[model samples]
Target chain A: MSVPTSTPELLRASVEQFYARHMQLLDDGDAEAWAETFTEDGLFALPGRPEPTRGRAALAEGARRAHTERLASHETHRHWHGMLDIRPQDDGSVHVRCYALVVATPRGGEPRLHRSCVCRDVLVPAGSQWQVRSRRVTRDGF
Target chain B: MSVPTSTPELLRASVEQFYARHMQLLDDGDAEAWAETFTEDGLFALPGRPEPTRGRAALAEGARRAHTERLASHETHRHWHGMLDIRPQDDGSVHVRCYALVVATPRGGEPRLHRSCVCRDVLVPAGSQWQVRSRRVTRDGF
Candidate 1:
């Protein structure tokens, strides 16, 4: 694993951009593209889950199964990810922390706050882009 | 307004230690000490609040009135802050993102998850230590 040679500001910008792209893919329901945001062995786990969804294929399947089922067929999903704190580690993996607010709205109905969560991600640079090595999400208990 | 002379790793350790102390003081109901963790003009605000509670005096009063209210009269309160992401700013201040879990245990009742929130904080160096410049907490709508 090569160490990050980029300046802190540049590193932060890359992580932020990765997050923006990830959120867009997820909110757009492009599960395949969303999965591409992670490494092949990446895992997405929620609290109380015995095991995380490992591998890109599994990650995509989990997203669709979890959100698409609850989402109204007539509605679209929206996700807001902000309050980012990006830290670069010695091994070159960048740690990311942000809050994600998932909302659903029907064509004419009101938008609803479906889930509010804090997500931590370990992103490893792959070529010119970064891929999530692991993503652990904890939903708000309230 | 000095740039943080410390490296990213060292800065992270400092911020982590600060958060640990902050949580301990708040959980211990040491409002005075907790308030000292902020700058003289520090502001703590929540969503839906018109204005932030500013200044040391006001910050302490708010902490006591909010958390200490349930401390001994009704039940004990515990706050857990975790998943912290610390970022060094250009101006030497640091940006912090973390998840805070508040649990309530009635004198004889079961422990319950009271509230879950995502907090964003801007911490500036004051003398030898870091002080919170501002903190904005957003609660989960769910």
Candidate 2:
């Protein structure tokens, strides 16, 4: 296993790139593709909600379902992320806290802020890339 | 006014220390004290919410009311943060992102996972310290 050191600069860049890719994949409507951003034992859940879907396969399925059930079109939503806290873990993984503003732009309706989620992500090194091991999404209000 | 162009390490450390202190103040039941983390012109708001209070005075008032009206105590709220995205802005300030989780413990009840809010903070240099000029809170859930 590659020992992860505190390269704050690199980690900073990694997060920016990760958010960028997330938006791109989401816009592409490729749930499966987006799911690949996680590790095999990855989890995705609404933070503080009690449970999360475990493993990459389940996460992929969850993403697919969420996309189909909630979003009408990829163009309907856009997001901006701001970091609040970050720390590297002992196992060469990184823990992140971020706030996101998701805006929904329906066909003719004025852009509405859908939700703000405090996301907690655990990222691990996968091959030459950093893949998310888990994500807990928390939403405060509509 | 002090020049904000410090070393990268200093900038990063300042950010980390600022958050550590911020969390400490909140945990200490000093909401007004927490609000003091910002500068005179600081603007505070919770993202996705329409109403935002500007300036340190307003921010302090808002914090006081929220702490009182919510009738809640963060006495047991624990904050964990990670995933930092930091960029030095053109205006001699910094824009950053991080993910956070806040767990609250209530009296005679299971430890409740409180709202996880993203702290979007913009900092400007004040002497050797960085003070927040603006802050936006993006909460994940109740």
Best by DockQ: 2
Q: What does candidate 1's lDDT look like per residue over A56-83, in tens digits?
A: 9998998777567646566655566778
Best by lDDT: 1
Give TM per candidate.
Answer: 0.60, 0.58
Clashes in model 1: which pairs? none
lDDT by residue for model 2 (B1-142), tens: 1343556754675576567557655644577777778887778777666777777778777766755644454234445556667788878889877777664544334334466667777887767657788777787763
**lDDT (C-alpha, whole model) for all candidates:** 0.75, 0.66
Native A-B contact fraction in model 2: 0.00
Clashes of each: 0, 22
Candidate 1: CAPRI quality band: incorrect
Q: Model 1's A-chain: what TM-score? A: 0.87
Model 2 lDDT tens row, A78-125: 666654456777778888776665667777677754555567888887
Docking class of 2: incorrect
Write candidate 1's Cα lDDT for B1-142 as tens digits: 2334365545655676788898788877788999999999999988778898999999888888877577646887787665555677888888877666677789879876566566889999987688999999966543
> Model 2 has how many clashing residue pairs?
22
